[model samples]
Target: MSSNSPFPSLLDGTLSLPVTPLIRGALEHSKKITSPTTVNHCIRSAYFAILLSQKLARKDAEPLDAELIVYSVIMHDLGWAVDKSLLSKDKRFEVDSANMARTYLQSTKESGVWDKHRVQLAWDAIALHATPSFSQHKEPEVMLASMGILADFQGHFIANQLITVDEFKAIVGAFPRLGFKDQFIGIMCGLCAYKPETTYDNFVGEWGCEFGLDGKGTGKEEYAKNRLASTFPRTLLPTLIALAEYENEAPAE
Candidate 1:
């Protein structure tokens, strides 16, 4: 991609982090999709995944294997890029995504830098990120899968931010599971104000918050905290914490 090209600009909107051929391929694939909505969502999700991964890396005490993890998450939806129908929670799609990552990586100049084992890991992570049920591998695979799921979730949340207040209200009206008002309150309580919530404290204290969600409320504050608190088998809290800090630093551009 050209440095001044829109593709690079689009990619540049992502977190400043390492990317692999697998990730690049996913973006290229996203460009080819026939539907504007799907293309937009996938593109945003790709950027979201990169942002979340970089945020997580920042908060880590030890250096993270971020390139590998972020690359895996970016490629998680490759199947959807190849065929819109592959967006479903089906085995074929999962395999397609995985194979796409492997094929793309191998076809690129970076292929030599990554060994066979690393490529295998990438394949496994990209493939199962969308289908955790199919994940039997551990470590990077699990991490990648969790990142992908959370990326998708956070992408939707970010996408909502782009909508008008009325449009957002309509979205929440259609999807009550989002708990719009509650989530908004939660975000306000945590992020902007950086204050604790008595309600979240009470709920999490009684229920014992998983990650940071128990008493975190359900607003943007909670969403931020939830992003940090979520983990494997639940949500990736560490990753969210990193992302929260990164979001805090994002330039207004």
Candidate 2:
């Protein structure tokens, strides 16, 4: 679609552009169901993954599957859609999005292009993208996908090492952030409201405890109790309280 190069020098001619019907279908599906902010984020994440792979010279060790990468990244956040029917309460948002991506892959006209192994790779990437320790050790597809996501959200310090500032501007210029930080948190909070257990033991749970889910507290007391119980000395209680208060007042941006 957009002819913008993800990385001016690294990914200029190395990576294959997604142009097949299945890939196009995935992009269209993502745009229809997800917000523009999310769709842009997914595109940026895919590009970032490719750039990271090129930077690490992992193309030969772990070949890039252009179609699979596009499909996986584009659909990774679909579970966070405002349409509750698209998500599953029985699973975490990550698993829900992964399952949806898998199902879409299985039903595509070019489904044969991706075998069971490839499908599983994409699934694992989406499901474990939030867990660096786990995803970083998996297959190239999984690891790179997660890295791309991390780079987009939390890798600002390492951006210079990964790609040039001009390249970064090009990527974000094409797909603007558009208040992604606050919007993403709001989406996670909504997920917590729908399925509280899904957020437990994850970063979303911490956000819930800090911000309160849908303006209603979700396990705030339990989270506080756990923090208090885990602390070694009661003497640190006042300091912890002060820090928590400051954090609560701090801007999420």
Candidate 3:
């Protein structure tokens, strides 16, 4: 990957992918469960995170483990897998994904390579990848991983000038988006329909607010419109929807 490194990257020249065996395994597992869109997003997140980290130029920062970033981010959305079994009924999608990544690291054939600390680090990166307020302040690995993911979703808002437009195009060129927004929203909506409780606190909850299968209002749009009309005074729309749903669901006297 680097000038002095012996590990040959699957990518060559410029920004490269240090293709380790574990990374390969992680990619295969991701492909088996989730759609190719997610798989590309995960891989892109690693490159974006690494490049952004380098741009940050933290003096005396510990060298980032690229394999760890790739392996961890690659499976960050295993909870969104088409396999269904990985999608838990009770836990948030992030939590489910984190647990799966942890298990993979623990079960790898490379003994002594992934100690408990490393495994936990991977868990933190995937689990907290969506929680910028907290993850942005945690370890470099955690923050970088989260930022990388946020960049992929939010783009310039999160990356600022760190990742230039050309750089972004190159990354997206290598890994085509393929209607990521629609696909991602569809999956979250499915989550809301299947396990609304798990989406109650996150952005997923917003899409969940729309799906009628949750037994909320007459329908999603009317319910959301009603909530928008009333709850505008108290809280944010997504938070309001989640709170209203929970309040309505409680057993009444």
Q: Which model scores highest in TM-score?
A: 3
Question: Taking the tens digit of each residue's C-alpha lDDT, what string does model 2 give over 220-252?
Answer: 676545544544465577678778877757687
Against the true structure, candidate 2 reaches a TM-score of: 0.78
lDDT of 3 by residue, 107-224 (tens): 8874248767778889999999988988988888888888888889866555456777777777877788988987887787777677766665677767756654343432567434
- Across 87-154, the per-residue lDDT of candidate 1 in tens digits comes to 43323444666786777677777545788877787777765564445553566434544554544454
Candidate 3 residue runs with Cα over 4 Å from true position: 1-12, 110-112, 210-253
TM-score of each candidate? 0.44, 0.78, 0.79
For model 1 the local lDDT of residue 69 reads 62
Model 1 gets an lDDT of 0.47
Ranking of all candidate structures by their TM-score, best first: 3, 2, 1
RMSD of 1: 18.2
* Candidate 2 residue pairs in clash (backbone atoms < 3 Å): none
> How badly does each model clash, as a count of residue pairs?
21, 0, 0
